[model samples]
Target: MQGGAQLPLPNPDSTPAVPVSGHSANGAAPGPVVQAKESLLAAAAKARKEKPAETEAEKMLREEQEIMRNITSRKALKSVMENAQGISYTRNLKTGWKPPLKVRQLSEDQAQDLRDRFHIIVEGENLLPPILDFKDMKFPAPVLRQLASKNISRPTPIQMQGLPVILAGRDMIGVAFTGSGKTLVFALPLLMLSLQEEVRMPLEGGEGPVGMIVCPSRELARQTHEVIQGYITAMKEDGLPELRSLLVMGGIDMRTQTDALRRGVHVIVATPGRLKDLLHKKRMNLDVCKFLCLDEADRMVDMGFEEDIREVLSYFKAQRQTLMFSATMPMKIKAFAESALVDPVTVNVGRAGAANLDVIQEVEYVKQEAKLVYLLECLQKTAPPVLVFAEKTADVDDIHEYLLVKGVEAVAVHGGKDQEEREAAIDEFKAGKKDVLVATDVASKGLDFPDIQHVINYDMPDEIENYVHRIGRTGRCGKTGIATSFINKNQSESILLDLKHLLQEAKQRIPPVLTVLEDPLEELRELEKASGTRGCTYCGGLGHRIGDCPKLRSQNREQQRNTKDYFGSGGFGGET
Candidate 1:
């Protein structure tokens, strides 16, 4: 274009290039496939120079368009490259290789030994499949290549057991720690199945996705979507049919997602509310979705997504596989699984409601008013990349601002903030642009941030499970970390016994006060044992009942005496 800012030429290496394995007999380069590369580049440059952004929204929209354009161009280039003579489709598939089913059936003693070693318990017909190594599984070469590239030689305890059950066409429940590779336990199997099904029965028009992953929060949904995208890219490069994945969640352009839906997606990683919105609006459908996964199922129930989940599930057709994964299995989660899953296999890798053993835990008995002071001191002494947690959104913001004013780079994520702000805060923290992240329990769940060295509970969470997840932010993926909590009598007294027990179980040092606080349950039992009726139901005081309670009887007698005195003394005020 004349007198326009010239767009930079696309780098041949910048395209998504896969390794070429085949060579021609003449030992020459593969024939060049023609594409409108120069014209597309010029058009993109012209579009950018033709109009200047007038507002923030406009600029954001333009940026999004540019990104989409770039992605489309790259995809086109990859297609052209794949069509070259030396690069053949289906070359990445390990032909005729399958995982051994003999290992699937283990003797009772062997299963027991395996359970003891990994703390894994399998329920329901001993259906849990054992993965001695990643290589033992029947995976596409691209999936294996991606794992090897990342140096993942063996499966985590959760992955080792969970994969087989799902692949066996059975519903499964996985209760593992926060960083136990739970996402892949389902994603890998689902993708492999989708590839097989797509080849066996090509998708009809707008048949929708064969795989669906629902996460509790937007951040977690986005993260899971990214991981799925990586696998999808690897699969595509390895000559599998193009299977598109979409992230349908709040805080992004819904129209873009709708457009993607119109085009058709093979997989969807979404949050409950947004997915419900799309489903209700008739913008998407899940009738053909064969695989369903609820990542962090316990967190979803805790966040009041049970109703939304049910509402979405009502839309799904029968004949689908289901998987539920959580860090802890509460009664609600168990009930949910019973309702959603059919004869599911339960895989528990570790003790439920326990913090990661790798974390160093400590307690600071500070009053609510003084927690800020102690937190400041702790921050001053601690290293960077710390995650501070608060019980309330307001407190998260306050702590975040206080740290900033004190000259520490910090960010905050909480329910009060919009999705964009929360995402931005998390991005900044993940990028190491911020040294500290002040957050509420919202960030404590399935969101994975790497190398977090410290987790400070500025305000100890109300629930014991929250406490476990909060501290888990630091000690992740088998890394050593520190977790310090600020506790007070008013807020933390009720959970003192359980907290102390958990810390002791993890072999962590407990504060003196925590050890001293009486257990409410034991105290109640003692009260019941001492007195048949511990307290008066009416008066709510110990050592009394409504009929014979001293306080109540005395009040009734005093009222009668007052009534008699009023009638006898008033006698019409001398001449009644």
Candidate 2:
């Protein structure tokens, strides 16, 4: 490599000519040095005159540079150490997160191949380390034990890529199917961070939680809390620190949650609404929170919780590791991730807005009045442990009532229900006491209920993502399930294109009604052409039907008048 190059020096003796009446003194023009000097001066002047404004990216880059400079400064280092309480915040914590066995630097081709293989596309630095199995990246003994106990010998696609990113302490937005074990992707990291930092359960009214997991629904919140507790139990068995995890959500007593907060929990799994309420009341503080996980993040954004999520994010003082796990990646989610996550590594396991392939989808074009009849028929054919999704709370209530009157064991849950009622309904459904659970979109995402034999769409969801989520209730964890959609004209047209695409992708049969919109028949087109016009069908004349033609009316009127006049005269002559 060429080390360094030197600039050509100007002739030392080169001098500018003294112009005497547009003539050089020595009868020679200016030397190259003088020309070069003049050019340099002119370029300097032009640059100063045309200085461009700094852009946002440039500003951020400069800020990053400044931060790097400051953090390495002696004074800044001293301040950070003082704040660290004499414990250095090392790059490698005691979390048992070791670097990969052998880091192979991937070429561009290799990275592209890997990305294509996993449907993974990262936006940040190419910092992904490879791991062939769960054992490749060494986890804590207790965590590994819990995994073994659950017979989780291998990692899923999301888990495989997600664990490395989470372990490396980089924010991520994981997009996978509903049953792709998204819960554990963040749960394992949360446990690791807590254990590595030795975060203990806070004393009564002493400090706030160190980790916060915000879910979209109460059942999911409780479910996540239970999973965390499982890991906590394993940690205790391993003689690690005991952690307290709380499930904070609405439809429950605020006093109880406040008391739990006062008892000094290490982790809080909550829904956005209740969590924001607690934040407003000053009952919970997230200043010390280090791990923030948003499960079913796309659903949260769709439910109009963006502002609440942003407000919750405002409470964090120090920089926190944020992870978002969503089943579908909507534009809203992508935009939210842009604002919420910094250089997040996006792990998309498959195509977005696609339903699980294991689900068998069937669409019936039934009118609104006959939906109940069809639903009843479907219920008769389907087995128990079914989930029927409605678009409205009133519909859910009506279905629940109708089912009860029909002597079928069923329960209802919607946004209008109290938290206790929702919990009880979910509990009954989970315990198999109730074979059918009628619900709104509340239970669409993040609520894990295994053995859901069928997911019935009593009313087609307005959004495609909701439809995916509705059907996603079943077919979880590699289980074969059926999804029956009762799509009428009202829904069939608006969602016909998306529905067809989804069905095609899932390898399900597309109904005839959904096809005409995509590929209309020739006969149907001719009939539509005739019916679509305003002219009479018989004569092809505008503004009148064949039965009410003006020419025919005149002929009939003339005949009637002439017959009356002539018949009257003949009768008069005969009488004379």
Candidate 3:
């Protein structure tokens, strides 16, 4: 199992406890399913006795409602499942072979014949099955030449799948290991559609461009923006009709984004929140968007941006081609696809949630207190170009301080750090002035620093899936990478377990040691006991899941009772 940080504390609330795989709160195996029912009742009673503000309870209820709303939204889910039987097509153009060239000395007629032959072959080239190409390789030339001047010569598998689908103007869902060039998958297509449109249509003044790429993080949006810029640069080089692009995301002044959008961009890559903010105000238009791509679709779900995604899509016509790309496809991703796409082509480049092929993975079982020691050992051993991902802001600070004390050049990046510090820290890391960069999720999104050899998860992610995102920082651009995590005695190993299942499914081997690892359930129970309430697994509440909740049950029973009363109490149920 991948290692995880078992939270030290519990929530103090009257909510049913989550049945973690570890021991129960009393340091014993959970007595029984009956005991679970009793504990929830007890917790509920305790919460009532505490008589906390109704306002807090109300807030909690609202958050829960929103969470379900986010999950239940059928758009992405339906779009995905409806297409789940999956559509298949075949092309025999060529596999593991390049297009043939004949530059050998030839007569003019032969040259013309060769050129005609090239066109005929390309026009008639039968493409291969999607699954085969996804297993390996990058994009074709028209896309590569555009990427080359941008200095990106090789394509990742995600790009390979996405580029084709995007150009075909079909809905697409791309899932692969993180840092597998997922951005280019959507961005290149976005550029192709727009730039190609600029060429095909006499933009002699068609209302600007007709595609948009939306991302959740500012850094990611910016990374995507830069890639688009590279493509636009290529377009200009090719002397194609001029294409324009812009970035719209948070932490940046809206005035700038508003002005850029007002000036008109064919492709606007923005964060969901900010983009929605613009859309609601009638400043952004999707009425003409022929193509749309959601980069990091899973992050938007995790960051709770479903409403924004829906809101943005609501502005577009259903006929628009939508593409959603994520490093990993969780349930939320399926839901997002349902709401957004159509009978689209689906591409699975790598086994979902697995580490990058370039990244070597490892874990060490250490005590929470000893996490610092192992981190130091890793820093000392690594040749200094490394990144450290901490699960919390405090951990980021502590690790940064420790590294500083060790005389290792290091800096931290997170939400609490001022914009200047954050930017400076990223710049320093990018400039190679910092030996190590300690960060939170902020660094995990869309960073493209080259030569980074190690990604250390200082703290394992609470959501097991985030493991893919955090470790994505290294092993990018065809480079080899390594990821190491420190696991303590009480930390949750569900992540490792989940990862093991995912990897083994992909035909990767599981470590023999993991087969006999400590009990995850017991560890979770201890942590939950330490925390006032077992962190709510249902809606991530403090103590309970949705199905087991008393309030929900009461609502159901009340609903049934009211139905009987309305039916004239034929003891209606009996009569029926």
Candidate 4:
């Protein structure tokens, strides 16, 4: 082509010319193109020959998996050998535990007399006598000192019987009224067991905790952990080998808990969900956990933790001394105890679902719209350091805000709040900085708030058991307190009837509204009295007999629906 000139077009039928292979028409070698292709091929070959280095996280995970595999293998081998020898893994584990000769030497007459005096009823074979005083427990000096420091001079009815039962290494089912010192019954024994285990064989990394306490709520778990820590601190001060503990619950960093586990712990106080999560992830094992206490067992079951509890129990390779303690024992808890505990002694300090005698329960009829205004009046009925319980979180928040706007120093907690917020509210209320606390049912069970002058139910709970627990916040540790519950037309008659019976049982004044509600089972109860029997052996609800128990029927329906769903979802290969 001529420079700056147009070239002539070629014919359509003419043959096309081709350039040489790997060379441009400009007569230059394609060195760069060739090098680029070679570079790509070399890189592909290198990639095929070598693998990328693992990240730090991957390396740590692999190491953990390897360790877990080794541990599992060793456990399997031990189990197989033990099975072959027909030896029971847990038969000899608790042999070292024995009641003191003084406790054992008590005659049956004296034991019966003590039980009668304390109003304690114990059922089980080979039962030990109840301890009349804290000194009768023969606890370690540090433990006794801790008790003394708390000014706990004597054991309550439940503690009187429960201490001996647990200290003797017997599985137990403890039923008592709320605020009956049920915690110490199991807590002290757990500490003693952990100390005993540590003294015999110090725990190494991934070896323990020797004891575990499963609480129904995060707040309860934290409280139990603090209690154990107090005793642990006392023991350490007295020159005992230091014992480590961990609080495992949701709403906190898992890494912190995992790190604590890596260091080893002698006692673990945990909630079911978090504990099950860690156990499933292999972050902790129950191989060395011989003592397992289910605090607020009924509450846990009510919260739908029965399956999680069972799964956690399955992780144990050997039998564990299982203890179930609650203020109320429904049929479900009884069934659970039968399946979980081995020859458990049933220690009943008072009838299940009974109100605390020390609490003066006051019921009132207030319009639903006016409850907020009346809440302030209720607060005026008592001094500061009062607890107000509402059934819903939204109501709790509303009350909290209302109280604050009205110049009342109030803090609120519920399941909906962040963990930090909940903890802060509880801490403030506990530290006596807050005058009042508004909360949901989450705070109803197993929370120990000392010196709580009053508990006002802004709204009545649906279940009678919850009412018992809510009012139980006050009147703790042999102190008299008051519970003011406002009931309106919106309240359920069933709960109202139950409340009426509970008030009459506690010998408290019943409001006109509650008094007007007729008890459906009054005739049945009279007949039962004539028959030398009573109402609801299953749920302890005086309003209904066993066959008519709402809780029992509800649970049965739930189970049946679950079964139908399971089968319908192809759980088994069969036609519907």
Candidate 1 ranges beyond 4 A from true positions: 1-102, 380-382, 520-576
- Cα lDDT tens digits for candidate 1, 6-107: 988888777644335454446677655444346888999899998775754344335543533442342111112233433322212122334486775667
lDDT of 3 by residue, 368-388 (tens): 888887788887656868999
Query: After superposing candidate 2, which stretches have Cα over 4 Å from the reference?
Result: 1-96, 103-121, 199-205, 519-576
Residues 232-321 of candidate 2 have per-residue lDDT tens digits of 999898888777788888777899988888877778899998898998889989877877888887677556576687778667666677
What's the count of clashing pairs in each model shown? 0, 1, 31, 0
Preferred candidate (lDDT higher): 1 or 4: 4
What TM-score, computed on C-alpha atoms, does each candidate reach? 0.72, 0.71, 0.65, 0.80
Query: How far in Å is the alpha carbon of 448 misplaced in model 2?
Result: 0.7
Task: Give each model's whole-structure lDDT.
Answer: 0.73, 0.73, 0.62, 0.81
Q: Tens digit of lDDT per residue, candidate 4, span 355-417?
A: 899999998889999999988898988788999999998899899999999999999999898
Best by TM-score: 4
Q: Against the hidden true structure, what lDDT does model 2 obtain?
A: 0.73
Candidate 3's C-alpha lDDT? 0.62
TM-score of 1: 0.72
Residue 312 alpha-carbon offset, candidate 1, angstroms: 1.6
In what order do the candidates fall by lDDT, top score first? 4, 1, 2, 3
